[model samples]
Target: MIIIGERINGMFRDIAKAIREENGAVIQDWARKQEERGARYLDINVGPGSTEPVRVMKWLVEETQKASDLPLCLDSTNYDAIEAGLKVCKQPAMINSVPAEAAKMERVFPMAAEYGAEVICLAMSEEGIPKDADSRVALAMELVATADAYNLSPDTLYIDPLVLPCNVAQDHGPEVMETLRQIKLISDPPPKTVVGLSNVSQGTKNRELINRVFAVMAMGNGLDAAIADACDEELMAAVATARILLNIDIYCDSYVDVFMKG
Candidate 1:
């Protein structure tokens, strides 16, 4: 599974403060920690709160690339910020996303294809997030079609099925699995499936427990990646174990090395 560390985002209070204060050391420290924790891509979100997202994102991407060769997931709702980060990135990276909305695709997909950057497509459109599995699958198909029109291969896209909080939706777990299964069925060669695994646990008391359980369940339903806290040793261990059990890893060597090395 591809682990995209979802730390270093301006959404977090401390991280937002760090960026606001131009604390390069704090951001660099996050980059190093995620890399050391086996993250394949470090997700950097210079969110709405940043006064200068383009400048901050560019500096963050450059500084992160200098510290490690691991690719980055440039995260922003702002197209300008995305472009700025892409300009300075040293390796093929991911765009944190484009919604299934038409305007979003028009703005982001062309840039993604032009720069050879992979994209994450959310299974939600301007109509808003789907309430059922079939609608989610339909939105994913729409995203795939949009990418195809740009000559982007399915492998270059990551589909996020928009996992909602279990507190609000009691059947959130099954709905996510159903969406994953439906997406796999729709594509001849399926795009990599991912989710914000922690989202399912939002508003819940037992966050870690719920996150691990949902992560394992999602993997079973063909999820190939996730935006997660890579620094959580136990949660990462659960993911590694699930991957090994699913035969996604051979001999458990990769899993063992990821956990036991320290």
Candidate 2:
């Protein structure tokens, strides 16, 4: 499974401070730490705090690249901010998202194609997040169709089933897993599946435990990637173990150690 580190986002106190202070040290430090902790990509978000988000996005990309070579997942609702980060990113990056909405698809897909970046397609539309797997899959299909029209390959599109907080929407957990399973059948080669894994545990007391269990279960249901806390050692270990059990990784006594090392 691909792990995109969620630590560099400005929503976190440390990251928000770093962005505000223009402190490259903090940003670069987190970038290196996430890379060392087994993140395949670093997600850079200026969050909603920045007034000059485009400039901040470029700064974040530059700072992150200074410490780690891992590609970034440029995350922003602002199209200009995403494009700014894309412009400065030395490696090909991933767009954090475009919804199934036509206006968004028209803008983000072309930008992704131009930059040769992967994209996360959210399985929600203007009507808001669906309450069931079938409705979410319908949006996923529309996302896939729109992306195809812009010449974006299914392999490069990550379909997010939109995991809601389990506490508020307990029934959504199974629905999300079912959506993950069905999303894989949407096309030949299919769009890759991902979830903002932390959302599963949002507002919960035992957040880590919730995230770990849901992550493992989601993998079983065809999750291909996650935007998550890569620095969570126990969580990563659980994921490694689950992957081995699923035959996605070869098992060895030291498999967890080996996986962490990567």
Candidate 3:
């Protein structure tokens, strides 16, 4: 599974403080720890809290690059911030998303293509989050078409079928899984499917339990990646075990080695 480390986001209080203080030391420490723990991409979100996200994002991107060679997932709803982060990125990274809205597609896809960055397209739109599998598939199709028009190959587009909180809607996880399966069925050489794995347990008491169960189910239904807490040992163990069970990795040698170093 493609693990995008989610700890560096500005939504977290400590990280927000670190960013506000321009603490390169704290940011570098987080990046190094995530990389050492086996994260493939480190997700950097300026979030809604920052007034001057572009400036902060540029600094974060540069600092992260200085600390590690692992690619970043430049995350922001602000197009300018996304562009700034992309500019400072040393490697081809992932844009942490565009929704199904036409305006979003127009703004983000061109940048993605120009920078040779992979993209994550959320299965949401101007009409708001879809509640059913069919509507979700329709939104995904629209995103796929938009990417194609920009000459961005399917492999470079990661489709996130927005996993909802199971505590609020018990059927949410199954619906998302069905949507993922449908996307794979429709696309010729389907785009990679991913999720914000923590979304499944939001507002719930047994968060780790919900996250692991939903992750295994999502992987079984063709999920290839996730944005999750790289520091969570239980979640990481679940991810490693799921990969072996799904036959994505042979034997568990790589997984074991990763944990041993941790």
Q: Enumerate clash totals for all models, in the order shown.
A: 0, 0, 0
Ranking by TM-score: 2, 3, 1
| lDDT measured at residue 229 in model 2 versus the true structure, 0 to 100 | 95
lDDT per residue as tens, model 1, 1-262: 7688898888888788887787777888888888888787899898666778889999888767767788899989888999999998888889989998898899888999889999999999888888889889889999999899998888889999998889998775687799988888777788888898789989999999988888888888889899999888878888888878888776545665655332
TM-score of each candidate structure, all chains considered together:
0.95, 0.98, 0.96
In candidate 2, which residue pairs get closer than 3 Å at backbone N, Cα or C atoms, i.e. clash?
Answer: none
Candidates' RMSD to native: 1.7, 0.8, 1.5
Worst 10 residues of 3 by lDDT: 253-262
Candidate 2, residue 75: CA error in Å? 0.6
Candidate 1 clashing pairs, residues 3+ apart or interchain: none
- Displacement of the residue 79 alpha carbon in candidate 3, Å: 0.7
Model number with the top TM-score:
2
Of 2 and 3, the candidate ranking higher by TM-score:
2
Model 3, 81-122: lDDT tens per residue?
Answer: 989999888899999899999888999999999999999999
* Residue ranges of candidate 2 with Cα displaced over 4 Å: none
**Alpha-carbon error at 155 in model 3, in Å?**
1.3
| Index of the highest-lDDT prediction | 2
For candidate 3, the TM-score is 0.96
Top-down lDDT ranking: 2, 3, 1
